[model samples]
Target chain A: MIERLKDLWAHRELLWNMTVKELKVKYKRSVLGFAWSFMTPLVMLLVFSIVFSILARGGDVQWYAVFLMSGLLPWLFFVNSLMQSVGSIVANPGLVKKVYFPREILPIAAVGANIFHFVLQMLVFFVFMLLIRWHFSPWLLLMPFILILQVVLTLGLALLVSAANVYLRDVQHFVEVALTALFWLSPIVYPVGLVASQFPKFMPLYLVNPMTNIVLLWEYAIYNPHHYGPQVAYISFWGILITVVFSIVTLVGGYYVFARIERGFAEQI
Target chain B: MEHAVEVREVSKMFKLYHENVRSLKEKVLFFRKRGYEEFWALRDIDLDVEKGETLGIIGANGSGKSTLLKCMTRIIYPTSGKIMTDGSIAALLELGAGFQPDLTGRENVYLNASILGFSRKEVDGKFDEIVAFAELERFIDNYVRNYSSGMYIRLGFAVAISVDPEILIVDEVLAVGDEAFQRKCLDKIDEFRDSGKTIIFVTHNVDVTREICDRVIMLEEGRIVRDGIPKEVVNHYHQVMETEEEASEQGNRKIEITEVRLLNDRGEETNDFYTGSSMKVRVCYEAREPIVDPVFGFSLDDYRGFTAFGTNTALKGLEMGTVAGDGVVEFDLKSLPMLEGRYLVSVAAHSRDEQTVYHWQDKLYQFEMKSDIDDVGLLYIPCEVKTGPQAG
Candidate 1:
């Protein structure tokens, strides 16, 4: 695995070029260009805040728009990265068959392109927090660490699905359906307290999902944890620890599966 | 001699599944083992290529020539054994294989060069030379999707040749481009050869193998059948192909042409004759049952597949009497008025009264004609020189 990282490092220029090409091609002829990236999550935030704040009355959380935006941006990044990376190998059959390079570069480049959009959306979230007169906390500095963990987890899944999709095209559809289910299962649209109160026994199983911890960490960074009571602060610490372990395991497992099937990709694709 | 490439007992096998389950429902519903067959594309192949030697591989379709090339370049790994190469290798398997149509020619050149393992600085250094070689100076900024097919091929060839690798693998990529560009590309290859670069060329064009390759390997049915000097190997490949064709044709025989012989004017069987000499083609056939009015004919073609002359008994208003078991029909040419070159003879028997062709053999027999006088073009017609003052 170290050797593979070294190989990828040697081809860093190729990875960078491919990522830039993806970004350029995505918004090549459009007049709105990069604005679409911010527009998508913001528009989703608007619709969710309207529905949840008016209908459900936010339950007990305040500043619901800020809570929704913080989680929605990261979720969009994860889902978009997986969707693009899953088809990356099969989509470039011409390159896959003709050239010799680290096959993982395709998926890694897809994740890198989406990371650009993720960072942009985070900036928008920061601006919204300031407008809502949210307090500044030194915990915001730790947000990068959490973001890195999320990226690692996403990269692992992307590698596995991209390589597998070369052999089984149904992987793309499976991922689409799986992402929808995962979105509702995680605490993206509603608060984590609602799930804990409704099913206290099932909360342990629900916390095992890496996205659950990731979304809570984003909330911890954006919203002051003191306002959420003692129970919320205690869960955030354990959630961060579980997310770290889960990210490492997923990344390692995904890399192993990707390496095993990559040798046959030229023939299968 | 120092070797540039070495292969020992290498083989590749591909599994052919009875049914490829592309969807989850198909996999879940089918609760039995999926049947499959294994196909061996290369079997325990062993060979060595010395440094600077242009080795040519020739074979019929599906004879594993491209598979061996791909294996050598590591595009696909072998199922067993080992292969080793000494230097940086570049392969041109298919022209324009990675060019994105939406990008401009300038952008694509950089992108394609990088994919071929050139660094950004290296491409920057060679960018001008690549564009000049491709002759796309004025249109370099235009998207490749708008470029003509010829322009696209030129650009692809230019970018491929610009990268100077220690070893090059070319698989019939020169089959495209116009005559001038093809010649230029071949010239560049020759220059590379002079610089002591190892080249592996795979082509079906015998003339190219004879012209450029010092050594040749002939593959058939996933095994090496012949390997030696270009002349002998090419001859063996042609003979093997002819025998295979005859064996396959024999399986579906109604009125089979058992033997075809070329006889001289003195009734001596020979494939070598002088230009303008009378030659006869004797086609001996066997009939499984009695048949009537079967047209017998033969065509004479030059080495380039240009037909010099063709005539049948029906076209000449000649009739052959019916035969039951075995008989021979002979075509006697008054003069073989063709230039000094190797020519192929094809024979056919038709029952179509021009409708059904019972048996047809293409380029089945080859003959050589010699001439003392120097001449050009496909045919040499006898003419009387009458150089005199113009008549008013």
Candidate 2:
């Protein structure tokens, strides 16, 4: 894994070029362009904010908006990155067949591009909080740690989904349905706190969800510091552990599958 | 003291599919439909190249020439083979494989050069030399998409030669560029050859093969049919093509040419029919029809399959009313101007335009011109060159 990391790091220029190409080509002829990256989540955040405010029966729901934003932000990054990377190898079959490079670079490049978009949105998230007087604590310094977790989780999912997609292309379609289901299963719209009270039996299962801890930590760090206590630390620790393990397993497994199947790709393509 | 490259028992098989499944749904259901064909592009190809050796590969289309080069470069892996090389390899298996239409010429040159394993500093070091060699210095900043195909070829060739690789693999890239650029490329290849570098050139041009290659290998249907000195291999290749043409002609019609042989004064199998050499083109044919005014015409074509000169018995107003049944017709040319290359011959029998006994045997016979004399253009247009201290 360290050797693989070193290789990817050395080939960082290729990643930069690919990421820039993807970013430009995606919105090439569109009028909205890069703004669409921000516009999409902003639009989703708006609709979710209105509905949650109405449902929670009117309180100072600024925290509620921040909560929803935090959840949507990471989940959006994961979904977008996974979808793009799942199709990455297939999309660039010409490059893969002609050149000899690590196949994992394709998915990692997509993940890097998505991370760029995620960082841009996070800046907007900060402005949203600044508009309101959401108190910032020393806990905010750990945003980089949370961002790293998000990147790792996204990378793991992208690697797993993209690799599986080569053998079983049905995963691409299934991923969309799974994502929609996961959206509700995660504490995005409402809080995990609400879920614990509403359905006490499923509370432990919710804790196992990597995104649940991620969203919970993001909400705690930004919206409410009092809530960012031992639980957030515990959630962060587990999140880091699971993501690291998931990343390694997905990367190793994906590389094996890619190298094994790559020879057939030229003929298949 | 040793060979620059050694290839042992190299074979490559490619699996080709009828279609590419781009969408996920199509990919998932790909197994339901089954029509795949396996083709052996190369088989049991063994070759050895000494240092500073120029090896030419000559073959028809779909022969294993390009595949062998690709295997040596590791661009595409061989199914079973072992290749040992002494130094770095630079392959021009195709021109313009790495250029991006969206990028500028300068940008694409850098990108493609890097992809070909030249470092950024190396490209920078030879950037001016490459641009000057390509003759695209003025338009270096223009987007490659806007550039013409000639411009693209120039840049590709320039960048490839700049690598100065120890071993260079050239495909049919020279077939496109203009005459001047072709000369430039040939000169560059000669320079590389003289500088103790190894080159593997794949081309259909027999003359180029004979002129530049120390040795030539003939490929037919994914196998090496002949490998030897350039002149011998090329002669054998021409003989094979002539035989195949004769066989095909026999299969097509009632009139069959048993053989078409080019002979000197003493009748022996020889391809070397040079300028001012007494040559006989003997065509043994069997006639199935009652033939009258049977006009037999033979043609001399250059290496490119273009008829250089030809005339028939009836066309020349020599009324030789024909009585033909298993006879041989010979065309004896006194002096042929063609210099130092292979030439193909074709024979035909017809009375007039409508009633044809037999038609064009396009590749019936072949001969070679072994001249040390220099020819200015495509053909030797009898010329005189006098040089001394320039008299103003």
Model 2 lDDT per residue over B1-392, tens place: 26778889999898676775556668657766846688999999888888888999988788888777767765567789888788777778666665667677887777667555566677889999999999999999988888999999999999989987888888877898899999999999999999989999998887788888999999988899988899778866765665555522423344556678888756776978666566778877776755666677888876555678888877777765655568877777666677666777877766565365565577656777776665544456666779899789
| Residue-level lDDT tens digits of model 1 in B101-215 | 7788988888787777777898889899999989999999998989999999999989989998989999998898899999999998998999999999999886688888889
- What is residue B66's positional error in candidate 2, in angstroms? 3.2
Docking class of 2: incorrect
Give interface RMSD (Å), model 2: 4.1
lDDT of 1 at B167: 93
lDDT of 2: 0.74
Q: How does each model score on TM-score?
A: 0.79, 0.73
Taken over the whole model, the C-alpha lDDT of each candidate is 0.84, 0.74
**Error at A171, model 1, angstroms:** 1.6
